[model samples]
Target chain A: MEKFDKLTGIAAPLDLINVDTDMIIPKQFLKTIKRSGLGVNLFDEMRYDDDRNEIPDFVLNKPQYRDAQIIVAGDNFGCGSSREHAPWAIKDFGISCVIAPSFADIFYNNCFKNGILPIALPQEQINVLMKDAQKGSNARMEIDLEAQTITTSDGEVFTFDVDAFKKHCLMNGLDDIGLTMEKAASIDTFEAAAAQSRPWV
Target chain B: MSPKTLYDKIWDAHVAHEAEDGTCLLYIDRHLVHEVTSPQAFEGLRMAGRKVHAPDKTIAVPDHNVPTTLDRANAATMTEDSRIQVEALDKNAKDFGIHYYPVSDVRQGIVHIVGPEQGWTLPGMTVVCGDSHTATHGAFGSLAHGIGTSEVEHVLATQTLIQRKGKNMKVEITGKLAPGVTAKDITLSVIGKTGTAGGTGYVIEYCGEAIRDLSMEGRMTVCNMAIEGGARAGLIAPDEKTFAYVMGRPHAPKGAQWEAAMNWWKTLYSDDDAHWDKVVTIKGEDIAPVVTWGTSPEDVLPITANVPAADSFTGGKVDAAKRSLEYMGLTAGMPLSDIKIDTVFIGSCTNGRIEDLRAAAAILKGKKIKDGMRAMVVPGSGLVRAQAEEEGLADIFIEAGFEWRMAGCSMCLAMNPDQLAPGERCAATSNRNFEGRQGRGGRTHLMSPAMAAAAAVTGHLTDVRDLM
Candidate 1:
């Protein structure tokens, strides 16, 4: 897993709520187990038209927001169907931070796992960020994972709270299993004790 | 001293050890696997030359990539690419000696459904899966949750997981649910009120008079949305209802063991004096037939409510809602009843159960789907599909011009050629309606199964109560 220090890029405003897994990476793309290669088809249906051509009206196709690395979206940004692929595709597409009023449970955790910073902000704060995001793709926003703050180009700072344990894991790139391995010695001791008592090993 | 909550009791019993970082090593009793995420984990195991530590505790099934209609017949006819993926899962499970319910097995369906139906999800167990809906097993008073592929491999090699403790949230429903209201409605209303992320970093314990009245299936539906509300898991106290639901299943205890297990399960509840980190209350009568007007699940209102105006919210929320309405081709202040639909889908893990099907069938009997509207009924599991057929509900759907298809996650995510055409709008029973959740540029209106059926007959978002 890559380490996250800071993310500064163009802000793209999807402005839609409940943007679910299917829209992030349609079900057909789920045929393969490989997590990579899905970014190209992220939002495939909306990104293209009946002729499979880029729909110029879609937010992703707007020339100014084409290279957006930060997504400022509406509330409940990743709801419906628990597919980790949604975060995987978003991360692979170069989106490192997602600022929303809320996110679906699974997709929010998956974002942290995949090195994306999903910031859950109050609706009032999110409104400001979304406006900043609409200033075209070049409207650069900065996110400092260490400081746990997001700043806009206009010098506005927003601080959000994260779970202490999750924050530790993200800072050190430790997942559940990685956290376990950190205590490999203690686990070995317990296994040895259980084996001796039961003689099943 | 703190009185024991159901979560505390379960967590204490399952703890194998506590690490230096304060994360506990949990002993997992069951691990469920599916085709989409398990292959990489299996490969990781083989690379390390490791054998499964407890094959009997693990089970595998194929669902996500398998075509719902031909899951049985076309198990061998998969595209060359998918064929290899499916074959890899089969071989991996075989080599590890884990129980594999392949497509050919009559028992095959969604992994979560198969586990509980087969009695593998018993009380006092900790279940893990690579799929998030794994929380469905918590209906049995177990600690069930989704894990990543790496953790899947780790559990395969060692049936244990490192988990951080979460705060306890008690969501109590105080009043009786009115007739025509179901567990789906309650959960949808909760999501709408809680803003989808309301339960983050907590284990939600459902209680109160209304929750106790719900059947085990209804309880499962409530817990199923725990993930949607940002909770690690949701649980109900184990009572006679929980015990009766599990007794006599193939995987459940029998004889003296059954009696002993029952005694243990009886103690799995929060004491009268137990304290919770957070408590939220909702009156059942306040909930209505919820329908998502925007892309998010939280973007919902009662079926009779109008689309929210842009000025209703502060900041850019108004503009964002406006943009979503434009993409969805809906106008502000338009009555939800005025939105016409091109398709209707009534199935998924969320609402694809026997009761959900029965609900839909009741509304569709002797009724015809409106012209120019296509409706599809996909059961969540093969077992559900068979039971619906046996109950003659399939006939009602077919007679109503709705497609009666085999079971899998069909049209839920637009996988397996089941998708809405670009710009098409659908009234879907499944969980979401994000932009293109059904297909590219496809618009979705999330509703209950019965509501979806009503929309199919009306060609518009009509309240199910109106049809009732």
Candidate 2:
């Protein structure tokens, strides 16, 4: 896990709603267990044509937005499927943060686990950010996870809510396995007791 | 002491420890692994130099991305990428000392179906899988949910998950289902009401007369789509139906152990004074043969109704409906029954069991598929396939101009060779209707096995009641 703190980068605007995990990274591209190679195939179907040519109109393919490190997307982003590959692809593509009106629950949680900041903001706030993001390469968006604020190039600011525990983990680059191992003694005791009482299960 | 809802009861029973920040270490009793999602988790485990903490508790099966055709009998015959994923899982399971069911094994099936069928999913347990449809195991009164690959790795390394308690919801459906209606219809109706995001942050416990009256298989069908309603899991109290299904299975206890398990399972229900964060009630009689007309599962309507106009909706909903209608190649106000389909897919984790196949077979018996229509029946498991053949259901489907394929998740999504071509329309017995889910530019209508059979026979979205 990588620590998420303050980041300033060009933001890309993707205005499609209910952008599901399948659209983020189609199932066909999810074959590799390694997370490193997925960036190229992120949104493979939507990003490429039959001849494997980049679709010129896709937000990521546009020359100005090709190096975007942030995404201002539509509501209900990552709505279907629980593939963590969606976040893996997004992070692998170098998009450190995703700002949307809302997100599917699993995807929202997975982002933190994968070291990507998923910021849920009001639709009005997203509208302002989306417009700001359309500025592409010339403009940069600043996000401070510790401050819970996103600042635009023109000085507009928005705040978002995240779970306190999740915030601490993201700041420290701690994964759940590391957290669980912190209470290994408690786990051992509970398992021993459970074996005596609920052995069959 | 406060009375606990079914969700709370099962959740509390599984808590290994509770954190000050509201996180709980939930000890998972069973871990279901599939080919598509386990590879990365395994890679993470390898990278971290960790081994599975409880190998005996995990069951691995390769279903997704495997070729289900008869000619592609082995992994070598599958596409290079698919074979690699499946091979990685096989190797990982072997290396980790976990039990695995390969494609050559008759026990190999969809993880959700295989868990219950093999009795690995017992009452009052916690089950997790990397697949969203893991909620299907909640039918057995277990607290089961789909986890991200990272959490899958966490569970493998620790045999526990750090989870916050989910809000509780009681969705009580009273009255009996009408003759032509089934559990699939009830679930679709529920998703339609709740919308895709309605059950977010909640674990729904389904109760009431209609639910109690359903068979175990039907209950599984209803619980399987809890994720479609944005719920992490759905629960049903354990009863004789659950006990009956569990008894005599490979992993189920016998003799003294069975009696002891039965006593605990009987006590797994919510008390009369149980509390829930929310309660929703729908009359079972109100449900009909339902089908999703749009991309999301929540975009459903009764088969007898006409498509709703996008302009009739408000705000962002209007745009969404219009976009969906455009992708589906449908017009507002068009009768659902009038929308012709190009194919019918009768299989998936949602409705690919023996009972589901029997329902479709009854409708297809002595009847041929509509002219120029393509239809196929893929059972959920190899055991289910054998059972269907034993019952001559496969013969009926084959005689009716339908392809009888081997057991695997065929046409549920486009990972394998079984998929719709561009611009093709299908009546699918699968869970999702997401854009290009079946194939690029493919359109899907989510419905029950009987409804899909009816559509196959009529060449469109026909109500099963009309066929009856």
Candidate 3:
């Protein structure tokens, strides 16, 4: 996991709604256990042609957005499948942030574990960010996790809320397993007591 | 002490540890695994030098990527990469001392189907799987939800998941379902009323006369689509129907133990005066056979309704609606049945049970599939396939010009060769209607198995009641 406090980078606009995990990283690319190298297959069906050539019309395929580090997308961004590979693909592709009007629950949590910031803002603010993102590589967006704010190149700012524990974990580069291990004694005690009280379970 | 909802009772019983920030470690009683998601988790375990702490509690099956063709009876003949994934699970399970049902096994099927059928998913247990439809187990009065690969690894290594509890919601459906309407219709109707994201952050409990009257199979069908409605899980209190279904399965407790288990399961329901964070009620009589007109599950309307115009929607959904109409190749105000389809699919975790197949067989007995339209039926499990064949349901399907497929999640997500060609439209009995879920540019109209059977014989989405 990578530590996060702030980032300023070019944001690409993906204006589609309900961008499902299947569309993010299709099942064909999910066979491998390794999370690395999936950056190439992100949106495999839409980004590449039958011959494996890049489709020039797709948002990420455009010259200016090829190396984008952020994405401004539509609502319910990661709607299907509980595959964590979706976040791995996005992060492996150099995308550190995803700004949407709203996000599906699992995907939103998965983003935090993988060091990707999934920011949910009101539709009006998302509309402003979407336009700012369409300005291509010239317009860099700044995200300050410490201050819970996203700032555009043209001086517009949007504030967002994140769970306190999640914010702390992102700032400290900690994950669920790591956090759980911190309280290993309590878990062990609870399990031992449960064994005695609910032996049949 | 405050009165506890069914969800609160389950949550309280499963907590292994709680942190100051409201995070708690919930112990999982059962963990179901499939090919697509577990390989990475197994790899993570290997990398971390950890072994499965409780292998007996976990079960694995390779259903997603395995081919359902009768010729390739085994997973050995699948695509190279797919074969590797299947074989990886087999090897990993053996190495970790976990039970696995490979494609060659007669017991093999979708993880969600196999678990309940084998009786590993019991009432009062907490089940977790890597597949979204894991909520299917919740029908047996369990707390179940899909977890990510990282969490899968954590559970395998620790037998517990770190999480915050979800809000409790009760969706009560009263009145009797109209003729030809099934549990699938009731669920679709709920999703239509509440948008796809409506149940987010909540664990929904399905209650009332309609829900209690449903068979165990029908209850599974309803709970299976809980994820589609954005709910963490959906549950039904265990009853006589649930116990009857779990009584004599392979993994179920026997004799004296069974009696003990039954008594415990009987107490899993909520009290009459229990409180919930949200309570929603719908009349079963009002729900009709449904078809999805757009990309999301929420973009649905009754089969009798016409396609909605984009301008009919407000907020940020107008653009989404317009795009969905374009992508679906549909026009505003056109009747749903007027949309022609090239194929019909009658299988998924949602509607591939014995009763579902029986319903379809009843409709297709003397009818033939429409000319130039392809139709297929894939049973939920090998057990279901064999039972259908014994009842001569498969014969009716084959006699009606529909291909009778061997078990593995045939065309649900199209991880294998079974899929629709681009631009092909289908009337499917699957849960999702998302873009490219079946295949790129492949249009899907979600319906009941009976409706799918009717569509196969009509070449379009038709209300099952019309044929009945």
Residues A158-192, model 2: lDDT tens digits: 88898898899999998778878888898899899
Stretches of candidate 3 off by over 4 Å are A49-53, B74-76
- Ranking according to TM-score, highest score first: 2, 3, 1
Highest DockQ model number: 2
Instruction: Give me candidate 3's TM-score against the actual structure.
Output: 0.97
Cα-lDDT of candidate 1: 0.80
Candidate RMSDs in order: 3.9, 1.5, 1.7
Error of 3 at B163 (Å): 0.5
lDDT of 2 by residue, B353-440 (tens): 9999999988888999999999999889989999999999989999999988877887998788888887899999999998889988
Structural similarity to truth (TM-score) of each candidate? 0.87, 0.97, 0.97
Docking quality (DockQ) of candidate 3: 0.60
Winner by lDDT between candidate 3 and candidate 1: 3
- lDDT for A29 (candidate 3): 80
Which one is best on lDDT? Answer: 2
For residue B95, model 1's alpha carbon misses the true position, in angstroms, by 2.5
lDDT of 3 at B105: 87
